[model samples]
Target: MANAASGMAVHDDCKLKFLELKAKRNYRFILFKIEQQQIVIDKLGEPNESYDDFTSSFPADECRYAVFDFDFTTEENCQKSKIFFIAWSPDSSKVRMKMVYASSKDRFKRELDGISFELQATDPSEMSLDIVKGRVF
Candidate 1:
């Protein structure tokens, strides 16, 4: 019986099945942008050196806090825009993510548009932002 079971497991079809199962187990992080009544899903790339620089200034205990900046485009005028995401977790399990849209001319200043959301999954598949706050400055 042991020989028979091992033979079944060694089959090519069984190997393919295992590979498919492993692929399904993988998860990806998603970025969402909500403007007006429409919600857009944005794609995120790997973290850059700036992300490392930003986090290095914080203490080791504060590693749960992170900031991600990406390039995005506005819906109204389809103009290119830049966004900064600030995520923090007190326990390192549940994270609160905040979004800040920056002006093209003055990237340092935060715009009126922003969004906030929460994440509790060990590996989140998605994050969203609502652009209702308008301009703050």
Candidate 2:
């Protein structure tokens, strides 16, 4: 299917969800939880990924968290880190999705933006969230 006047697909909600708080029409939309979208947060080299696990599982949960400019075209350039999004569950014993982020490149290239991501939490007892998860797409 397609939009009435636009040529875009009609069923790409999930892909469109990644959109930032941008304005496209005469009105504006505000999400109650903006931290769950593909918005940018910081470039402060996040807290070293919490690396507290020695037996964490592979293929762990990797949400497309944080989108850096990374304009690698100058000598004074450096890797930047931004928060952009969060998906953490406030009431979970395990390391829940506190937030998520991704690249400005839209690496996944989904029609709708992604919310918080989830992994199996293989070693829920022996992993630090920064280490167990926190890898952006």
Give the alpha carbon lDDT tens digit for every residue of 1-137 in model 1.
Answer: 11221111112332232233223312112232323222223332234433334333333222122223333456655644233434322234312221221111122112212323222222222222333113210
- All candidates' lDDT scores? 0.27, 0.27
By summed lDDT, the worst window of 10 consecutive residues in model 2 runs over 25-34
Per-residue lDDT of candidate 2, residues 1-137 (tens digit): 33222222322332343243221211112111113332332122222222222122122343222221111123446543222332222233223333222122233223224323323232344234453234433
Runs with alpha carbons beyond 4 Å of true place in candidate 2: 1-11, 21-79, 82-120, 123-127, 132-137
> What residue pairs are clashing in model 1?
112-134, 112-135, 112-136
Number of the top-ranking candidate, with TM-score as the measure: 1
Name model 1 segments beyond 4 Å from true.
1-63, 90-137
